[model samples]
Target: MQVISITDLNSVVNPTRLAVPIDTEQQHFQLAMKQTCMKLPTEPLLDAHPQIDRWIMEVGLLFPKVFEWEPPQFLVDTQFIAKLCTKKKDTCVQINTNAVFHRNGYVNLIEWAIRHPVLNWSDKVKLWVATEYLSLPPENLKLTILALHPTHPGKRYEISWDSQQHEETRNWLVSVVTKQATPMKTPVASQVKSPFPVTTGADFDIGKIEEIEI
Candidate 1:
């Protein structure tokens, strides 16, 4: 929804405010620096899909991310922003180049998919629901991404990534979803309670978000 240029980033991102000093945590800090430094030209925000709930259910059954796994951090680097909560609140996914930022004393996932450059509308909704509602870990989220295959007769689905283990992936999904005692809520204006604490690995001290103002 917003467009920020690479040249303007210096004013927006204050390098000295980084939570992880460059010397001690080289890899993560460098990643954070690189993301901030290589700011994308535009940030795209998707409107809520009418069939988001149904697609969420489908992704839960399919393992799409296995085919193309882009973790949360990767999403951040690509400048994906999922809008959630009320527009009046301006609440959406927050991040610095380094990590997810906590807002209003809590990290929330609402209905909208935050910005990412590449995901299709369907994949965008799946990531939003999985991160905000289902609280699925990256590994589990991958499989959930694939269940929304096109409806065609005689369509086949892989149960596992491993050629030798036919049902391994399917069986693992069964265990994971089964553990959730609560049902997921439909995407709506109101917040849905998650069954577990949601933490994207991108989460770190809020101050670390100085690199890119979400």
Candidate 2:
């Protein structure tokens, strides 16, 4: 049997994609996976959160018509329904016996987009929120910016911010914004298909393997 480093596996898969250096440590790889999940395209929604797959299947079975509609119409309908379900609390149960609501309701909209390719949705939605609100401090921000809506009168969302929390939030925001401003360097190696199944764990001894087959 042959053994290989996580770095080798990542090089074969896509070097630029992984946020953490594969050779560093197993715990780092896990953290990288979590961060990468948020950055990756929405097509990998199921991969990022496998639970969404089950939710999608359940939702599809309960609302077959959702699959039949055009992608844009499906997106609009599901988003509207999700909002109602979140607000009314009873809307999910009323929709179908199998229907269940998630607190992160927008997830259903994402899952719907994944199932329907015509929508051309991407992870840019996350970036849009970041860019729009980057200047706003975390403390005073609302759950969302409703003032942008045409029908709503100018009402601001407000939250209490303690000094300690405010400082921490500010530091974090600055770090993230600074990182985003920097351009990422691409690896010199060309992209190649991975031959081995790559896995990360804390217990694996990197020194024991002679050669990784992949």
The alpha-carbon deviation from the true structure for residue 48 of candidate 1, after best TM-score superposition, in angstroms, is: 46
Q: What TM-score goes with each of the models? A: 0.20, 0.20
Model 2 over residues 1-214: C-alpha lDDT tens digits?
Answer: 1222223333333445545533432233223333333343334445665544444444345444434544333223121111111221211101100111234332222222112111110112221222232333333222211111111122222123233543443333333333333455654334333222233322234334233111
Q: Tell me how many clashing residue pairs each candidate has.
A: 12, 2
Candidate models: Cα lDDT each: 0.28, 0.29
User: Model 1, 30: alpha-carbon shift in Å?
Assistant: 6.7
